[model samples]
Target: MWSFRTVLTTALVGLQVAALLAVLALTYFASQNVLLAYAEKLTERVARDTTTFTENFLNPADDAAALSQRLAESAVLGTADRAALERYFYEVLRSRADFAGIFYGAADGSFTFVSRDTSVPGAAYRIKTIETAPVRVVELRYVDPEFRPVSRRNDDADPYDPRTRPWYVKAKASPEVVWTEPYIFFSSQRPGITVAKAVRADERLGMRGAVGIDIEINALSAFLSGLEVGERGSAAIVAQSGDVIAHPRPSLVSAGGDQPTQRFAKLTEVDDPALAEAVASLPGGLASLQPGETRLTRFTAGGESWRGAVRRLAASRTPWVVVTTLPESDILGPIHRVRNIALAVLVAVAAATAGIGVLLARAVTKPIKALATQAGRISEGDFDDVPLPPMRIRELDDTRQAMRRATSWLRERRRENLALTGQLREAGRVLERRVEERTRELAAANRELEIANRNSNMLAHELDHRVKNLFAITSSLVALAARTATTPADVATAARGRINALARAHASTKDATDGTLAAIVRSVLEPYAGLEGFRLSMEGEPVTIRGANVTPVGLILYELATNAAKYGALRASGGTLEVAWRRIGDGCAVELIWSELPNEPVGEGMIAEPASAGFGSMVIEAMATRLDATLQRQLTPHGLRVVLTMRGLEEGGPLHGSAQAGGPAAGHSRGDAARRRAWTA
Candidate 1:
């Protein structure tokens, strides 16, 4: 026989066990999510740090030519001019935010440089800046920078010639400056960045020599190292070209030095394909498809399932990308623990709840037990039943009174409960009917939505096709008009101008099928790229405008170009032209300037403002009005300037480093002859 105490104890134990299991399960899931979040955060942080590192690392001057200019300015010094070279090197190093060393590789074998080791006095004139590392100087007659063999000996060795190195060789081969990913310094045993420029005598004479700078990676490492993803989070720095600068694990064990190699033979010894691939494709921002607790894959090291985030560092110049990793287990582990604690608490509460339920059940049964005793007493012929000692519970007292009342009207309540139950069953039946009707209505709505979606897709496709055809038609019309002109020169000029305009509009509209208004203006006016004739400036950053608006802008620019080509300063020799547009407060402004040669007389016959409003003038006025712009035309002895200020297309406000009227575009690619012809004729 089970006593009450034994039963209660057994139930409590069972409840506790159930609660503990629930807590453990919840803990496991919560911990996993937390770890995943942490991993993603870590990756993002690494990416951001790397991007910032690269941006500040490059330290580009407001002038792009500054780097090359500095090299040229210093190269003029004599070979034996160590003091001048050192001064220039120190100045160059100081100009950068992350330079660890600066060196100039002249055509001659002699090399001059400054190192990060400030402890070594500037006056300490050793044959070479590096004193300790074994110098394996390889004279690759074939290699520009002969591969310097890694040596351990400190004895007197040949000067480590950098010309034989890849960085020096590549820079020498190209006219443009080159930046290399971070790598361990062969001499200093520290990670650093290298930027090289092919020194030239002037703009015309190219690649006279090469000057280089190396920026240390210690500060970047510090930034990435401090980021915490979760419990066990890690971060790494990678170059834009996917070269791993910093990582948590050592996939490639450099034999003597820390140079990472992709030799499959070495990778086979380790037998980690994932790690090998990761090493081979490192510094890349990508992930694998294999599913696991870890959300991101492949890039992270082996055995550690983790969530990953990545960001590109210092956007201005360097292409370093930072990757941060969070071990899923570490970040989520605490949350799981907290969940378990909560589950345990909930379980204890559940057990208490169950115990209370049992007590309430017992209280309800007490009255029945009392009734049984009373019935027995009545059977024994004791008519006077002492009213059960005043009931403790109100429900029990009500029950007792009900029982006495039932002695008089017991049959009526039984019928009432039965009748109410019958009514409840009928109400349920009606509710079921209503639900069915609602379900039918929902199905109809779904069908309607499907039809609407189909129609919308069809409409979109038709719109795209029509827009393309409209552009083609417009282009054809312009070509025909150019060809139909009566005079041969006029025909050729018109055909050329109209064709160019159409082509420009088409180029801008490549993304839109037909060019947007903004695209049309940019492409048509682009040929007058760097005109000294007039000041051309843009106020608004380029924007995508509607096709309807694009046509008007295109027509207006065509008229302006035609007038300038025929009679404006653009027709005069040595004249300059500038066309620019930009968004201002709640509007946009487009200005075109044609500055004539000094003392050049204005052509009254061809250049006097059109006596009667022609299509060109009308078109200009209409377009300006459409854009809600204020139009101005000013004629100066030096040039004619046209200004149009249109509302609703303004670029925010003013910006730094903005192009001024007559300034060249951000990336103008034409040569001198093209620029000169466009401005003068």
Candidate 2:
């Protein structure tokens, strides 16, 4: 089956990936900016702390000069005990580790200074005293930590003059403590700067001497190296003129030389490219940089950008710049690490999302496929007998419900269709039967219509002939009776009686409420019951005659009895006749027999046929034909025997003869008093 799983899964995965990428991208850049700003702030703080450390080191020197000035004004320095003064100097030497010397330079070009000496294999203090008497002269010496003279040297008369030194010069020029220009210390031959103050015992005794202390380059370099900057960070102290007086990288402070090598280099003239770039980016050559404010500088070095922070030390008399620089790459390393971690998390999340998409797509599509198959089954008229499992997906569940409803509806329709089919079959059967009955009725009606048409054509002539035959039959009977009458009145009475019998016979055939074979026979024999010479016997199983067939049966019986009454049975002193009718043949047909018994002597001249065989014979023949009956005659010693057989008599049957067979000669039906004289055989 075709499915949407692939498309849906792909869409879901695509949406998840796009969302993750968007989040990762946004985080990478956003965090990059935040982390870089935080690192910048950190680097600035480190630079500030380093500068503060340098400034604090110089503050002590200025405090010492203030103490000496107060003591000189009180005459304590000039009158102090020698041992006490030496103790004071020894205490000063041990006060700070970075102090190279504490000395006094006289206005007359004489100088004296104390120092800690370690070159003599034992801890000691050294002192330098200068004399300008008889040409400039100098002496170098060493001292114990207690200010006891440990070693001394009369070096030489030298061109060096303490009075001409910047410290003495600056001390005499200013009332406040002064900082000298950075230079190599005369005793240690190390680069240094001095903080000096002028001192006098009394105002009248003019300037006596300059008290000074020196900060050597080695001490400053140690302080700079101890700076806890970034992994690739470097620190330096630059003088106001952009001179690097001290730095962690000594090359950054000095040019290479052996002859009293220059201990400092201009900030812009530093040998290291990265350091030079850092120096070049200083704010106003570091002199104009404000204290407590970080001056951030970015410059390219070694094909990479570096950030340098410079702050002018507010406490330095020489006005120095404390500078720290770090590579931009290291500063952003943590940001990149965070970014990579975020990317990995995004990848993992996307993978999980894809997996979930596939699972959900299967969950949805499996049910959909089942529903589709069920729908196809329903289309093919198989509405039930298929299993439908439940689903978890919302849309799939809704669809399953709809499918169930559809299948139920189809089942209902199928049941209704089955019922309707049964009803239609029943209706068809009823319609078919009705159609057959109508066909039979139409056939019967067609037969009746044909009979009516024939009756229409023969009605007028048949009526005229029937009327004439009635008159003729009456006249014949009257003529035959007159020959046997004694008088004219007697002849008339006999004719009337005979005519009344014919009239009653016709009426009997007409008013037949009882139309059975035996009933009709009894009705016809009513007139002959009281005859003195006649005996009649009617015997047979009773049978009913159809209405159309009744008239013919009654008329034929009357004719036969008429002949017996005229010349055969009723003429004798003891006459006998028998009439019988019964169901015969297939139980669906019947027969009636008629014959006479001998009352007088048998003779060869007995009536061979009816005396005229005229009206009676023709009527009898017509009735027999209409009834579809058989007739037989034979001569016997007692009388003539006549038999008649009819078929299809048990039920109303098809007519075979005449359109008019209702009455005989218009008066001879319903018939004679004694209809049949039978042999009873």
Candidate 3:
């Protein structure tokens, strides 16, 4: 019943329009749901982030108060030390910018406070002290960053007393730390809250005191104002008691006048219509919200739809609420715009398609059969370029020419593909060779790294062993010194001298493969060589001592030198000391002789027993026993002379019997016996 051209035009146009309409419908609905979800998620993320930030800002005040309480309880800080307390509070305020002030109030109505001084031009901190005992007066000192006083004022008429403040009262009553409700600071007149804790009377000065730190809320408001909410969106912090703690507009949260009783502004007085409506729309208001619970609501205010999320701060001792609101248009406006654009495109495209379809149907209906036959021939690879029957229409002729050109282009592309395939194969071979070389290089590098790691591990083990030995020696010295010394000062002096001797010995031998007896003697006695009228002479053949013998030999030398410096040779002046060593017993043993000549004459009876058989004699005897060496002392008219004979002095020789046989317990027993003998003598 229909002509071929008419049927084709009608079918093509109808199918295109139907497909376009279906795609538009699906895209619009899917996008609408996605945009709505995105808006909800964005609002919730803002609310959660704001709540977290608020908690962080207030946590520092709590921490500072706790720290102050501990210091007070431990008696490290007390009210009587007003100067120290003031300095400490000033430092705390300088370090913590968020704190408005730090103060301590005593039960006797005495107070010490430090706060930021913005009233003065060049002042960085202000110290306020109220004395109730000797004088009832307030002293104000404004200081700079270096604590230099810039200005000082005496306020004798000021009636401010910290004991009457709410923070002080609450802290004194509560056993634990407490936070006061948000109110205006007495000095700054800024809306803030205080974190305070009570100091037990028995702990410090036998009197009770409370410490408080004030945190301002204006910074919180500024933080909210700077937050990136959606366009035309706003956020606020509200307390459960119906006070607005923070708002994007900072002025809305603070009362303008000097009414301290009504310092904080209520939510209704903020003059933000959208925020007010959103809070009112919540069921039972923000007070009904539980901690860590989030509630979302929608409302209309000022003839615009608004969406909001209300979340309470979690784990907060203070009940604070975070509210974030956004207009509904911020979410749906973009979706609607995109939908309108799609519709316009659909209309333009549909009109063009229908018109083109009609023309195409009319033009191609006659010449289509001829074109199909030629296409079939081309599909079969018959590219002989045989001339076809001539077409009357120009479009059909041009299509015929284009088909020939396309066949030519296909043949050329086939030739180029073959060439390209060969080149790719060559490139693959080259890449394989390069990969093999790189693998070989990496393998070589891995082997080197493994060798280096083994060397590092070996060095670490050696260092650890040496450090442990040094610690053992130091601990023994400290214990022995503590046991024999009479006073704490004596203990410290004895231990420090012995430790220094050991440190010097270690440093001298740290870089050498083996330590020489002469080097150890010089290192131990170097400190006394610069004394006036003192002379030190050394005569020795360089004898190598085993690593295990270095510390003991060095300590023995130190004790003898210290005795000479204290009582015999180098005590007053004009003293000479001689240290000599020689290899003995087939070059395996060494004998060291220490000879001292003092400026003062010594009697034989006075030298029969050592002047003081104290820690020095004990140390010398114990060390000789530990080394398995013999120590002989002879007192002559010249001075004191000592001979120390040690075996197994060679680096390769077996260590001494005592060093190999004695553990810590054996060594300690010998030391105890030696100390007892010295005490008895």
Candidate 4:
């Protein structure tokens, strides 16, 4: 059997070694995965950047052709004015240096072209005019930067005709803008492509001519040469036919010759063996790539593993793929270095952990053995006090001290046994008094709880009563609306509007004993208060309304507001409504005036009065009866005015003739007739 110290030390060292090994393994694999993902992202980013650059280089030419087509079709820049056309073409060419030429070829073989003369030392513009009206002759005029002609010549030998060019023919055949394949320009003998569009002379006429803009491919090559790929990595732009359009090495984009007839170099024809090999190793080569799709692959190039990504440019008119390749060594180099460092750290920690474990175990066991010897002495009935064994560990030292203290305590307890017996009797008497006092306190608490319970029950009964009242009012409104509405839809609309108004009224008085008259009126009109050209103003002395009267007053306001919105001031432009109130009759009643006026003059008989009372008038009469209020109306030349007198509106006052105060009475009998007359007026 192993000794306790040996077992403890061995367990500690073993656990430490296992944990270190697990951590090392996890780090090694996780780092590899993370680094691999990073490499993939880097490859995709390079390809996307190349695609963006190519699009930027080519988009302008397409835009220019479209703009020029519109201009020509609109007759802004026409062939009738040769000087203006030349100046416009010269400006376009100067503004866009990448454009080799701007030319318009007509159906009758008439040509007007403007091109930059780069063959000379200084800046010069050449305008080639081929007039087919009189005779087929090419006029070449070289002008300075100011557009002043410095030299002019005629070449009858030049056989350039607008009707036979590829740009003209393709544009004429297709109604939309057309792009030609990469080819050598006929005039400049430079490798470029033409973007062209057919122009119609008139809306009813047939095609008259085509406009073409030549974009130099050398600009694209130069842009590609500036991109920074990873170390030992390169990027290239290749067409769908495996022809190299652009490369980091400009010389590789074209065949090694000064001949103007030479075309762009093919992928295999380029000197880059690694790029060619990577492209060949792909699943179906460049032709298999689709627009807006990025594909990543791994292949061996030049005896080295490489990661490559090909992304097709989605926005380009031509089908082109950006190929980016990076060496695998560049990606794995950092991860390998990190793994080596981690291994060294693991070894060092393991050695240190072994040494520390042994020292800890020895330190622990020495104190335990000393504590054990002390315990044995106590078990053998040695109750006398003795000095404790010295220990470095706090727990072991505390045990030795406790043993010494226990031995002394046992000796003293034996000597004081009778004294303890006497004290126990006195403690029992004191505990009994405490129990009696606690009982009395608990009884008082129970009494208070009963009072709180009663209050809660009262509150619940009040809430139940209010909810039932609300449902009763809602049922009455629905029944009344159904009786008067012309259609089922009208019944729903009227009932919903009235109930929403009641809800707003209740919300205004929620958590409050009462609310002011102005607040109640504003709440009912809130929906129409913010409408443009319809002004609403409220002015009052702030007379308070009892809680029971809030809903009644709100309903009356809703009726008046609805009438105004439908046929009164609110229906017209620049309408205004004014609500003013004042305290009346011993400060227990309020008199409110509602006035409406339109901005324009009202002619006599222009405002048509209803033949009979409508639903709104009935609602007003009902709500007035509920409030026990009096209403009177007047129709003046300016507008309609109504006055309302509400009684028993003071707080803590009895509402006269109200059902809540007493039984209902006939206080609103005269007011009902007056309200009807006012509603019809």
> What tens digits encode model 2's per-residue C-alpha lDDT throughout 1-681?
446777787787778778878887887778767866765776678778777777776788788877755654565565234344445666876877777777776678776767666776444876666667786667776665655566667877556677887788888888889987787655466677788888876666789787787766576787778776678777777776766788886545665466555556775577657667876776566556665556778889999888777777765466777777788778788877877787788778768877887888886577677887888888899888567787777887798878888888889989999999999999999999999999999999999999999778556544564466446556755765676689999888878886787677657764554356666776676555544445777765535577777778887887676666555664454778787766565567777888777587656555343534565666677788988988887667777788888886543532222211122212332333223332121
Error of 4 at 441 (Å): 99
Best to worst by lDDT, what's the order?
A: 3, 4, 2, 1
Model 4 segments more than 4 A misplaced: 1-26, 120-123, 184-191, 340-681
- Model 4: colliding residue pairs: none
lDDT of each: 0.52, 0.69, 0.76, 0.73
- Between the candidate structures 3 and 4, which one is better when assessed by lDDT? 3
Error of 2 at 201 (Å): 4.3
Which lDDT tens digits does candidate 4 get at residues 1-681? 564677887787778768977887898789777877777899899899888877888888878988888888776777677788788889998899889999998888888999978454444888899988776788988888888777888998889888887889899888778888886665665568889999897757888899999888877677767776667788888888888887888777767487756777898799887678778877987778778789988888778888888899995468888888888778788877887888788778767877877787886677676666666776786677666557777776677778877888876876688688789989998999999999999999999999999879766754664465456556755765676689999889878876786677556544444565656666755544444466877665544577777767776776666555544676555888887776666767778898889665655532233212644465567678887888887777887788989888666752332211101112233222121111011
Q: Judged by lDDT, which candidate is best?
A: 3
After superposing all C-alphas onto the true structure, candidate 2 shows an RMSD in angstroms of 63.8
Candidate 1 overall Cα lDDT vs. reference? 0.52
Between prediction 2 and prediction 4, which has the larger lDDT? Answer: 4
Q: What TM-score fits each model?
A: 0.36, 0.45, 0.47, 0.46
- At residue 290, candidate 1 shows an lDDT of 17
* Superior candidate under TM-score, 2 versus 4: 4
Off by over 4 Å in 3: 1-26, 186-189, 202-207, 257-262, 345-681
Best by TM-score: 3
